[model samples]
Target: MLTRAEDGLENLWDSRRAAGMSEPEKLLCRSNLLGSDKRITNYGGGNTSAKVMETDPLTGAQVEVLWVKGSGGDVGSIRMDGFATLYMDKLRALKGVYRGPEHEDEMVGYLPHCTFNLNPRAASIDTPLHAYVPHRHVDHMHPDAIIAIAASRDSRALTAEIFGDEIGWLPWKRPGYELGLWLEQFCRDNPEAKGVVLESHGLFTWADDAGDCYALTLDVINRAMAWFGQKTHGTEAFGGPVRTSLEPRARAAVAARLMPAIRGFVSGGQHMVGHFTDAPEVLEFVNARDMARLAALGTSCPDHFLRTKIRPLVVDFDPAAPDVDAVLGGLKASVEAYRDDYAAYYGRCRRAVSPPMRDPNAVVYLVPGVGMITFARDKATARISGEFYVNAINVMRGADAVSEYRGLPEQEAFDIEYWLLEEAKLQRMPKPKSLAGRVALVTGGAGGIGAATAERLLREGACVVLADIDGDAVAEVGKGLAAGHSADVVRTVTMDVTDEDAVAAAFDRAAVAFGGIDILVSNAGIASSAPVEETTLAMWNRNMDILSTGYFIASREAFRLLQRQGMGGAVVFVGSKNALAASPNAAAYCTAKASELHLARCLALEGAEKGIRVNVVNPDAVLRGSRIWSGEWLDQRASTYGTDKEGLEEMYRNRSMLKRSVFPEDIAEAIYFLASDLSAKSTGNIINVDAGNKDAFTR
Candidate 1:
């Protein structure tokens, strides 16, 4: 008796596509189709399952196997291996042993015993909810439209009004064994019901057919959306807008300043990457009159609360009289107050056996007129946190428009937040890489050494911003790196190192893109090989403009941003062996390189107090993969050394103490050491990556 709505949700299921699919494959297809839309569920926020008859590995007898999305898996991107297989009989038998809600945490340990075919994928905590549904297929989703109704003050009445007897409703209870049983009982009572809405939680739908189950989930959400649309039509959302939004450029400028300041305060233990959004929904909610009241109440859904924290820190900034500097000055105090409030919440809610308090810092920050900013240990998490807050905002908008919106009770939220199972999940997460939360900005990033350094940093879990004069080349390199590592960690900007404004803008972009920069690799340079008699003013100026002046500008901008962040930073200058060896017929290049080396020493001395370390990596004859070697500089150096272009590399190698050919990757390795914590205590020093060049050795 289920009817599909004319609008709101699309039926993406291709019967042709599912024609040859097995039951497990059909379940996966349905899960993916449902998860593909943000309107259906946020990332990693929903679970889907199917009970299929599979032959037992040992007995060769067919049994009902429950295939469900495994722990920490996103249905949209899940593969066959991501589904945990368990015996349905064993799952049902768990009901007899389950004592009560107080002992629900122990039930998670019993899941592994119910494993069918020894599937290695760990079953998620929501397994019982799907197992107890009493249907061949089940879907549990956190669609915004459905959650809007679930989180409303009259959630039960609203559910009845919208779907009548087709869908049932359950009161708020933390998701676990008891709630799964509650779902089973609800089904047993309402035999005509197709699904049920869990108050302040999400929607659960079931069907004997996978296609019908998928369609029912969409149909239920669509009905809710349609009903809310009609009931709340023409109503003001979140009590309407109280403030005007700043222009796009102005908003970005404010975010560039505010993000780094906030990052400095919260990143005391580890660096945090940031994500900023000025989407229409975020702007509408932040600028609304009831923003403070609604945000204070917190998010209703446990998934939303978990990612965005109990509540966001509302930044004190008025768009009417925008003064970003004033906001920046008071940022530390604001952040500290939020931490103190969070600590007090923990104190009031902590149980005798509760896990120790986590990072007291706020994850979401709301600035009226600008937008929302979220920070986490890494870029993806930060971005995902922002998305979850947007979902919360949508829920509030709908719930407040029709009926009063309700957040979970404080004790209930506290129990879920500090639950032992949640703590164990956190403990089981893999240890983060050394450079996990660090962000780096590399000049000349399109070049071989620059790209290699970016790769090295990214491999160790650092976000990298590639800046270079060649826009196309830098973008191409950024694209390739983004493909390897995620696009979240790689950003590219076209920059002229000698242009003061361009240099500052690039750093600001870096701040807005990934919070702020922690490491600066000053590698932009030019080479000119002319005898003293032939060295014109133009040639000398060109070398100095790029090598000396450019390095100074880039470093100065990096220092300014690092100071703004209040976090210590690293500056690694890509100098040359010629700076010390006094190469013939290259006076201009040698002089510029030496200037760069001396500048690093001065910066090292000045920045030591602030924990910013500056050092130099000197490479002699980096002929392979070097843009300098690809140009006229190679022919000029070969002519000077009385050798052909092909033999020039060999001549330089023979001149070195080790007689080994140097490549860009070799130089990159030295730069990485100097830029990372490996050289934390060794500043104002020079590393000769010239394959053992005695002439370039520092005494």
Candidate 2:
């Protein structure tokens, strides 16, 4: 057993754990262990494989099969189905039909024919690299320490010096069938080698036994880390910090201000979700004197640049004297210049067969004092892209510390970026949902209609911020929704809509959490049942305070963010049928609801110039799952109808012209229609979900 290196990787292989496992299970265990540490491999950045003897379905005979991590799978979270299975003989047979390098992409087309047992999971491009290696198990990982050496100026010489003939080195080659053949040739040429390093790529280690492969992979990475640590000890990173970092709160404030503006500039094609990280390493690099020079060199690993783009746009912001206004003033020009530069790069690097230039916007943005901001079509992708960039930063730190760092050549990077295979994979992806890039803030989100609306929007791919006065209840609702959808798209805030400061802060949080809000479901409310003569001053004010004043406060905040984002948005108010038809003994509720409806119209008129749409969905007697109906409102309404609480829903149903009961889901459907682009041309419109109430009819 190897002892753990100080601040280096640990040998996580366990003999006991592997004692009773099958070869495939052992491969899985090895992969999870290697992938658990970002120091070992980033999310979805590496592949692992094993050759196992399996029963042939057709002939009931034993056969060799290759089981490798499937396309678009993360090793740490992968399951059995995540591995693509292929017949070893059939994979070997591919070489006979393989053409030269120019026709390499067509080889991927033949991979499906090599499928073992009709496994539907698609094989990754790295499939051949593992298939051609004459070993029972193989591991390919992009560990920062290993990539540091791989990306160094003297990477080939450094590999020989460190491993001393035990590991070999190969020059940069884009991953495909041709590279796989090169690796096979390397293994045969250096029979005693434990593994080989692919320059500007990653590490690949293999052994006949799964445990040995796992141990060897860890050992190689740990040795690289130890070497880098010794060489770089007490050295200045990125030529030392030129700017100090802002305090955490101040950093957040700066990010909150910059993200919406940056998001606006980049989100021309589709709305982008933003992620912010002020990790120590990110701050170190962004604040350094060599930051721009190093960042402009771009990332070394294909996995890094594929997500982060060729390079990040470093924003001009000073930490000592933060002129955020100056930065904001020049942001448009800076962004446009970056886009122009990218187009020029594409123009210079394009081959006759290269795909057309994609979105010209930058994916990663670096602000010296604030942090790193990454934007993508959705929140999870934005977050992952930031993580990959952090890996690139670590690689740069180590490589620059020892030997000069080198990114991939522009032509090579461009080929990989616009590779036809990658384009095909992207084309295979399912269409995005209707609200795929939208962010929504739902008030009273713990209540029935509010939760339903949130759920509806979430299903259509909107990231939702659930804001409510009941913190615990809202948290529970958010948690439940996060379980169904991912936690990345669901956030909860404790908010009292009547509190102006609280409302503003919630909007800021939403901006920080999801770039900015694209939809505001103004549904926070309170219902009071009292006769005009019996209504106390406090009761009337309470109704007006939450219903009328609260709507104004939330809408005002949403409008501010939407205007800042420069993206038109949707605002759907959850009004009451009482707004149109007077209900006996509920004068305060009726009046406040009426005020809410008119406020929607007024805001719609004001917001139309900016492309912001304001609409309302009026619901009547939606008792199921309603928080309002769980309290005094239910008893009061039952009393007014001279019936028990059990009969209230039925009475309301009978009262409607259609004799159909309205539920929170029914109202949610109306709200969704108003909030999505289906109602893009609609503003100042009222959608009544009151089961054909003649009094509430708009026409």
Candidate 3:
């Protein structure tokens, strides 16, 4: 049974309440409690509320208030301030005047006016529904278990039979003032009902106390699940896909062909990354007996439509195509047709006064035998939407196990997708940061400077590929970045840049993961300090191979990929101060950096024709966070300089005109400027990031 975590609930509220904490604290606690359970909600999926008493600023008297979860806050991690406080009297008054026909828009607009504070965070669109429900605490969620029961064709009959009139049933009503008013009256009439099932939207359970409300929600879903389990015979209907496997190499090649083509078509030729998945669960759903019909249904919930879209687009694929380019061309045509069909679907349902329609690009793409690909402007969005669809597939399976899976009607899906209240939420979102649609690749990305550059690119909204020789470290770093950004944004490749074959394959992986690469930061290198007499041929070759040869390999591959893309691109090489001013006992390092700098200049000359910019960033004495400056290396370097590590670092810092040490972030900033369009007019230029080292200045 789905039970409440009440072990310390009262103690938490009592302790926090003693410190002038309000009811929002209690509400947020319950919100977090429910949201922590993915079976209840995931990410920012659900909202919650509590009615409390607060002093009215104007009247200087205690008044009833409705504290509902607000925008930009996830219930899973909500704070006390995350709930927007509104006067219950004003909200209740809205129900008296709200008329039919898109009153949801006016209700949303009026919510801010009814706020206790003059300038309050915008309340969620469901505030009216919370206001109308005469309960102290209200919990709303789109639980997969409950959805399986609620979204079935026989939902009403099943709900009535299971709950025995203990719950109210509301047919799909497009969530607005109309539904809010109707739901309020329905609940008042059915005083004994503890919860209400909104056909396909979600479940609403309420009680006089927060714990009771949360417990009520869990109890209702558990009962529905029990009934569903008994009816379904232990869920054997939704089995894994027909067992068929493709060799990894061949599967990768198919993705490489179709990813970029679909990206180009979806973005109208703009740059974007294609995130591909063929996980076991996804394969099972795509290869199900009724794949087409199952995939054509709407999203698991109305909230999901904003992310996953109404339905995924299913297309045919030929993994064994002899000509890759021909297959790409065919996929492009198919995507165009999908776009046309989306536009037609829009035309059929749109009202004259609807906001300008959204882009008709498909969010999720299903290819029989190949796998699933979800398209988004950025990797984070693509990953989130992909996750929602994966959940949807599982939910659909569960629903099918019990009964026929039925989602909202086609017109209702359109209504929610373009609803003005939801549109307002998007309107309030911050503008996209620069480099939003671009994709970047960083070599030695697991290291300090390279990792910093990758993080910077991700913050600027670019999908990033972190390529490093240390596969394990780079994958771990990518995972951390993906947790904050999108899963597809940071892809890792274990590559020895000197290996031409590995370089080529890494580029193919990037193409498959994110369509194509637009910017390449060649920053992978190791530090070697030794007397010229003591430097061995092996040491010299090692530095030369990874430094100069690696730059050549990565740059060559980037150029080929960008040239084929026919889009302007950039290549940035991370050189060193040794290239500009020779350092003692650094013969191999100096010689290789000089060669890499000159190589960048040569690439700039060739790449200029194709609108590709090439540049180099030369940084000096960047000891902090550098793997090169750790443990024995630091001790060795300090001994070579006849001082302790700290003293040596200070000496290097004071040697510069700025009297400060350079950081990896300093070099990363210079690289970003050169790689982005801000440096469009400049190419083949060396940007120095040595904190004003006179000798390292480009001359």
Candidate lDDT scores, in order, read 0.93, 0.93, 0.79
- What is the per-residue lDDT of model 2 for residues 284-311, given as tens digits with 9 covering 90 to 100? 9999999999999999999998999999
The global Cα lDDT (0 to 1) of model 1 is 0.93
Clashing pairs in 1: none
lDDT of 3 at 474: 89
Over the stretch 586-664, how does candidate 3's per-residue lDDT look in tens digits? 7888899999999999999999989999999998888987877775557766777788977987988888888988888
Backbone clash pairs for candidate 3 read 380-486
Q: Count of backbone clashes for each model?
A: 0, 0, 1
lDDT of 1 by residue, 284-361 (tens): 999999999999999999999999998999999999999888998788899999999999999999999999999999
Top-lDDT candidate index: 2
Off by over 4 Å in 2: 1-6
